[model samples]
Target: REQADLQRVFPDLYMNSLSNVLTQGMNRKKKHEVEALAAVVSWIARSVGANTVVDVGAGQGYLAQVLSFEYQLSVIAIDACSHHGRITNARAERIKKHYAAKMHKSRSEDRNLNMPKTVTCRVLSTDTFKTLSDSLLQKDDLQKANLTGKGVGEHSLEGLPDGNVPSCCVDSKPSLLLAGLHACGDLSVTMLRTFLECKDVKAVVSIGCCYNLLSEEVENADSQCGFPMSKGIKSAGLSLGKSSRDLACQSAERWRCLGKDAGLHNFELHAFRAAFQMVLFRYYPEILITSPAIGRQGKALRRQHHQRILESTLHHEESAHSSPSLSQKNCKKKGSCPTMNSAEAGTAKNKGTFEIPLSDTGNSTPKSCGAADFASSILEMDALFRGVSFNQSTKCEATKSVDKYSLFEKFSRSGLCRLGLHHLQDINFAGLWKETEPFAELIGPYWSLRAALGPVLETILLLDRLLFLQEQGNSLEAVMIPIFDPTLSPRNVALIAKKI
Candidate 1:
C-alpha cells in the first residue's frame, strides 16, 4: 500500500533516488526488529482494513516512516523531541521520492490502471496537540471579540462558544496508532492517554523504557490521568505491579549486602567507595585496575601512589603553619603573644595563663599570650587540620576502601552525615539503619511506589482502548490484535465491564 501511494504522490526525480538509497546504509539488526513488528501490525491493519495510523512517541519515525512508505498508509508520527521529528520527516520525504520512481517505472506498462498514491505522512511534536487545540479556541474568540471591538486578551478566550472551536481536520478516528520505542518517564504514559481520549484511534502498539523518572503521585490535579498518579503508573493510569517493586527492593538490598560484605569499618566510607567504584567504572573504565589479576600485580604501585598522596597532604599542612602572617606579628606587637603549638594552645585556656617563648631581646620581661589570640590561633589550627584531614581521607577511602571494609565504613558514615544521615555512629548495622531511615523516607518508598505502578497504568490504558472500541460498535476481533503483546509479563488480563 505504501509503495502504491508513493508512486502517486512523489515526483519522478525524488522517488528514484529514495528507492536506490532505501536499501543502503540500513542496520540489519535494527531493521529486523522494525520489520518483525511492522509485519505483525501491518497484517492486523490490513485485516481490519484501517486506512489511517497515528504513531505516538515515534522517535526518529523509523517505524512510522516504514509503514507509511511500505503500506501506503496515512501516518501521523508524534514525539517530544524536535530533532527526532525532523529526522522522521526527512525519512518520509525520502520515501516519497522512492514511490515516485516506482510510479514512473510502472507508467510504461499500464496507462489504464493508475495507483492512487497520496500517502500523507505528518511528523508532529507532542506539544503540537496543545498548540493546535489552543489556536483553534483562540481563533473563535478573536472573531467574537472583533465584532465587539474588544481585541482578544490572552485571558479573554475563557468565554468562547464551543461551536467556534477549531477542529483538527485529521480524522477523529484513526484505524491504527503506534508508539514505537518510547523513552523514559512520562512519554509512554502520554501516548497511552492519547489513545484513550482519541476515540478514532482504533489500535495501539507501544514499547516503553526508563522506569525511574515516573512520578509516584500526581502533583497536578488537572493532569490527564485524573486520579492521583504515583511514580510507577503512567499519566494514563497504567500500573506496573507489586513484582516490579519486589524486584527493585531486592536489588537495593543486594547492593547494601555487597557493601557490608566489603568489611568497611565506617558506613560513610563504604557507601562512598561503592558509589565511587560504580561511577569510575561507568566514566573511567580504563582506570579500573582492581581486578584480581591487576590487584595482585599493582600492589607496589598502589602503595607508592598512596604514600605520595600522604606526603603531599602533610607538606601542605606544614606549609600552612610554618610562616606567621603580618596579622599575627601585629597581634604579637600588641602584647598578644602566639600560642606554642596546638596542644599547648588547647590546654592554655584551662590553665588561665599561656606562656610564650619570646625572641631574646636582652630584656628581663617574658611575653604572655592573650586569651583572645590563643583562642584564635587554636581555631585556625583546627580549621587547617580538619580541612586537610577531610580531603586526604576522602581520596584515600575512595581508593582503598574496597580492600579495607573498616576504612570504607568510616568514610561512608562521614559522607552520609554530611548528607544529613547522622545515625552512622559506629559503622554497625544498627547505626546504619538508624541513620538511613530519614534519608530513605525522603527518597525511597515514594519513588518505589511510583515505579511499580507503571505497568498497572499501562494495563488500565490498554483496557480503556478496548472499552472505547466496544463503545464504537467494534468487537474485540477488530481492535484487540494490535494492543496485545504476549511478551509482556501481565498477560491474559482483559478489560471486562460488569453491570455494577
Candidate 2:
C-alpha cells in the first residue's frame, strides 16, 4: 500500500499535528517540526494525564517552548551545553514578552475576548535524567520552599545557576512525558532507557539523529551494540557498523539538490579527491590505512579547496621532527606567512599539472633532501588533492617546509589515513581517473539510493528500541510513528511509548 494508505489506516498512530500560534516567529522548517512534535506530545500527554514534560537534549528548547506556551504544559528543557541553554532562555523570554504584549493589546481592544494565563519557560543546563532520584525526590511544602526558597511551580535552585531546577524536581508534578527532539546517537537510547527505569516518566517521545555516533555495547560480534537493543534482535546477531550508520544518515534532500543542473560544479571536488587519494597511495603505499580517518580535517580540506599551502609557518612537535630548516626568505623577521582565502584564490587561478618525483635509488641520507624538494612534494599533494593547481612561479619560493616523506610516512604508520582513500583499490592514474569519472556521474543516484533506505534503516533501529521497551513489560504500548515531514526533516520518525 501507498504512504497515504498507511496514513489513512493508522491516522492516530502517526500522531499528525498542525502548526499553531507558537510557531509565529520561528523559521518554516523549525516551526513545522516544533508544531508536529508538540501536537503529538500534547496528545500523548493528555492520554497519560501528564501535565509536566522533561525534554532531553533540548537544544534551544523549540519543542519545550511550544509545549509550555502554546500547549500550556509545564516543561523542563534539559541540555548539556550551557551556551544552548542560555540561548534558549533568552529566546523564550523574548517570545514571552512579545506574547504578553499581544495579549494585553487584545484585552484592551475587546473585553469580551478570553485572556489565557501567562506562561513562563525555564532552561536547565545539565543532563537532568542522569541523577533522576536527586532531581525528583519529594519534600514537604515548607521544607521544599526552604530547600528551594522559591514558590512551588517556580524554578528551583537544583544543579543550575540562578535558581533553575529541572521539571522533574518539582515534587508536586510526579507524572511527566519524556521527550527528545532529534536527541543525538546514544542520548536517544538513553531517553528510552530512562523511560523504562523511571516510574515518574509516564511516556516517551524520541526522535534520534547521528546514528554513527552511537556507542557499541559489545566490541566485536560477541558484544552488543546500542542499536539492536531488543532481545530477539540481539539474539539474531544483528549489527550496523559505523560506516553503515553514516550511510543511513545521508540526506535525500541533499541528493535532490545535487541532482539539479547547477550541481555539476560539485563533481570536480569529488574527482579531485579521488585522484589525490590515488596519488597518495602510489607514492606512499602504507597511506591506504583506514582506521584513523582524517575526518573533519579532510572535510576542511575539501571545502577550502582553493587555499594555497604556504610553507609551514606553524610547527607542531610531531611535525617539527621531520624537518628543522625553517626558511627565512618567505618568513619575514616577525609577521605571519600569507595563506590563501576564497577571494585571493579566485583572482589567481592555477591549472598547471603537478608531477610527483620518484624516490632516489642511491642511499641518500635524510639530511641531503633539501627544503625545496620537500616543499615541492608537499605543494604537489596539497595543490592537486585540494583541486587547485599551484602557481609554478610560487613553487620556487623559499618557504619553511617539513620533510613530507617522514611526516606522511610517520602519519600513515600512526594510522592517520588520507580522505577519499576509504575504498580505493587501484592507484593507477588512467584507471583511477576513468573510475572517478563514472563514479562522479553516479554520485547523485547512488546518494539518493542510500538516502531512500534511510527511513527503512531508521525504522529498523527504532523498532529495535520500541521492542526493547515492550520487552521490559506487557503494560507498555511502544511503536515507531511518523511525526514530521521526512523531506523537510530527515530525522522525522519518532519512537513514542506509554506505560499502559
Local distance difference test, each candidate: 0.38, 0.54
Q: What is the lDDT of candidate 2?
A: 0.54
Q: What TM-score would each prediction reach against the true structure?
A: 0.38, 0.59
> In model 2, which regions exceed 4 Å deviation?
1-26, 108-130, 133-173, 218-225, 253-258, 262-269, 279-453
The sequence of per-residue lDDT tens digits that candidate 1 reaches over residues 3-32 is 122223222312212233443444543454
Candidate 2 local lDDT, 1-500, one digit each (tens): 01122334344634334334455557777876786777778778988998567777777677777777667676766666656666666667766776677778777534222111111223221244534423534432223322342322323335344334333455465676888888888878877877777777789999889998876553354443467678877777777778777866866655564423224434443444445555566655675564324433234443444323323213322343554344333233222223432233213223544332222111221232244433333344443333222232333232223222322332221121333223233324444455545565575456456668865666667778878888887888887766666667777777888998
Query: What is residue 337's positional error in candidate 1, in angstroms?
Result: 67
